[model samples]
Target: MIYLDHNATTPVDPRVVEVMLPLFTDQFANPASKHGPGREVTRIVERARREVATLAGARARDVVFTSGATEAANLAIGGALAAAGPDRPRVLVGATEHPAVLGAADAAAAAAAGPGTRAERIAVHPDGTIDVDDLRRLLGPDVALVAVMAANNETGAVNDLRPLVEPVHSAGALLFSDVTQALGRIPVSLERTGVDVAVASAHKLYGPKGVGALVASGDAWARIAPRAHGGGQERGRRAGTLNTAGIAGFGAAARIAAASMTDDGRRQRTLVAQLTELLVGQLGRGAVELNGPVRARLPNTVNLRFVGAGADDVQACLPQVAVSAGSACSGGGDVPSHVLLAMGRTAAEARESLRFSLGRATTPEEIRTAADQVARAVQRVRSLTQSTPIQDEVRDDNRARTARPAGTPA
Candidate 1:
């Protein structure tokens, strides 16, 4: 199987696996305890924390481990808003934000402002980057926080945070960047960017799942209340026993990603360019619009909109070739992509996008195989799908067509 959905999640690196295997049994101790075994786990967890912090160019004390990026995002958004105090605080988020950030902002606003405090969805440009001017207009006395992703997960567009951050700070509104996509894959430093809070996940960087970190430099955690109140872990911001194994794995993964980011990026771009060339050559012009600007996207991600084929049909047809429509959180639910909708794509166009996210293990040959499969599957789905809803995608039926190549699998 040619797996291409690295954006959704990635296989644990063999090294990460090696690091985690002993923790499951040998390092069996609650990190919260003070015993020798517990202290040993705590020491390892701190090393992981420092490594994660280093990747973000953040101080080690600023990092707090969580179950995953989702939890970190929630704590950042909800916690920041709750700490904002009274006044029916305003919460703003980018249109293309992941559900975790959006939902966190929603919950906080709902609690603070009753039902009507819906977050203002700042409009992102067609290329999937945010407009700082729009954000300036949206910022106000009531606005408590602004949430924007560092690099969009679906479109891979890197948000130019420098401009956005200045406006947000000038407005006295704190900004939280869900840098899960940017942290290890791109050059991100909290010191350089000056974002108030940033969230990152382990699995996204080839670490074990169930672990992520939130980095905050100042008293950013003061206003945010805990979603759960129990143990005094995470500097009393988050309450729970830490996932020692997951944190250890996360730190290890981040270190690897930091060291190899440049190399990985070059390889991914080469493969992406090769595959996109094949797609454009095989599929006619206007048959595809690369979802995000090729130049601005994350090197590892490629979101291709098959103009005349069902995303589900394309995905279903490529059984051994694994990819995703949008976020993996949409388990079994075939909803139109919110990211594409934000990009001004029609429902059909949104339904047509397929994400191919490369990873450390991806190769030139793998990309060619995936590209060939994609071309064939798109063509097959367009020809065979009997549904009238999809027929509208046909640009010109009168155009000459060729039969599927003999080598394509049944």
Candidate 2:
């Protein structure tokens, strides 16, 4: 199968696996313990922490490991709300935020404001980027946090956090970003962007799943309350036993991403352009409409709407090519994508869109094959829609003949 759904998850790199294997075997001791074995394991964990921090341009102590980005997002949103006194009970989240952030903001706000507060949504532009002006109007002293993702998962539209930071800061609100999609594919420095808190997952960067980090600046850490209370791990910020193997793999993945991002991005950008142009060329420009900004988007992602064809039907026709009709987490639901709708697309237009996300392992050969298959699938689905009435007429005529009285049709 040709895999083009890197935004959902990526295959674990073999080098990452090699780094994690040792931890599962010889380095199995708990880092919390103080014995010789434990001390050795603790060093490994700390090193991984530093590597993850380096990937985000944060200090090692500021990085809190969690099960995944979902958990990290929850911790950031909920913790910030709880720490913000009753006076500051509101949260403003991006319209196209992942469910993790949007849901967490609602639940956190409700818990903080006693059913009086609901999370407000910031608007997006027609190109799928967040509207800074909308976000500015929503920011106020009562707002405790403003959650915007560094990059959109479906469209891969990267937001320049510099413009958002000052506005959120001036309002005395913290800026939190979900960098899960941006961490490996682009250059993201949390410190440079002045983002107070950020969350990322390992699996998005070719590392093992079930591992992620919540990186908070020192001031941001002071405002976050611990959600899980147990053995006082993560410097009392988060409480849980560490996933040593997964953390090791995360560190290896971060290191690799840092070293290869420039070259990888350039190559992937070329391939993505090639694939997109091939499809549009084959299907006719009018038949294929690009969903997000032509530039200022992730090099590896392309969301396109196939005119007159439902995304689900097209996907069903091309079983060999793996792509997403929408966010993987939002799949299996019949509704059109919220991201597209927020960007001014009609429900019908949203339903006709598909997202293709390339990755480090994607090859030019695979891209060619996927383009051919996807183009054929879109054409076939459109053809079926156009021919359905004639097909139904033929079936009805056959039935009428079969039901006619014997020898009646002279």
Candidate 3:
């Protein structure tokens, strides 16, 4: 398959896999053990941690390994909220956060127990950028934490977080960014941004799944609380035997992504521009409306609305190419994308949109083929069901049906 869904998850880099293979068996000892074997395992894990820290502009000691971005987000939001002390902690979430942040914020607010300050979502524009005024108005002394994603997983929309950190700090609120989409692909530095806590997953950067990290600024260990309190691993923040092999792979991926940031970004941007031009230029601008800022977006992402098309129908038509109509987390929900709705898309427009993300392995030939296939599929699907009935018609994967062009009904 010609995969175009890097925003969802990426294949593990061969180099990363090679680095991790030996660790799984050769140095399989538990990191907590004091013997030579354990020492070796612990040492390797620390090296991986250092690499991850370096990617985020943090010290090795500040990196706390978790299962993935979801857990890391929970830890960052929950731990920071817990650290906020005495106050009925307030948490702020971006209108376009991944479920990791949205779900974590919900749990954190629920944990507030009393008539405590609750979490609020920052509004966003239809292009997927956050509402700066809404963000400014939301900040206050009672607000304990402000959480915004560095880049949207679905739309490739990049959030300008430098300003976010300052106002958040001015209000005595700590900023926690879900940098899963931004790290490695974009030049993100914890030092320059001044965020208190940031989360990232190795899987998003071509590392093994089930390994991620949370990096915090300053010495806030006293305030940070463990989500899973058990073994003393991760400096008591997370409990369990560390996944040494996965950690090694994460480090390998981080180093590769960090070292090649500029080049990789340029490559992806070129691919995106080419892909988008085909969508609008040849297909007619009315045929496709690309989502998010044309310039300020992740070069790998290209979300488009095939006006009058059911996203699922279009996704199914391109079996050889892997792309997503919505987030993998949404699992083909019939409801319109909340992110799109926040961005100003009517529910109708949101349902008609789909995402195409490029990555390390994507090629020019595959992109051309994928775009052509999508155009043909959209024409075919529109032939069968018109506009409103299309959703019901494409419920099955193999019922031979025809579609006609509706001239990009907006």
Candidate 3, TM-score vs. the true structure?
0.93
Query: TM-scores of all models?
Result: 0.92, 0.93, 0.93
Candidate 3: C-alpha lDDT: 0.84
Cα error, residue 372 of model 3, in Å, equals: 0.5
Identify the leading candidate in terms of lDDT. 2
Q: List the residue pairs that clash in candidate 2.
A: none
Residue range 312-359, candidate 1, lDDT tens digits: 877766756899899886445768988889888989899988988888
**Quality of model 1 by C-alpha lDDT:** 0.84
Checking candidate 1 for backbone clashes, the offending pairs are 79-224, 83-223
lDDT of candidate 3 over 322-370, digit per residue (tens)? 8887778764547788888888888888878989989988889988888
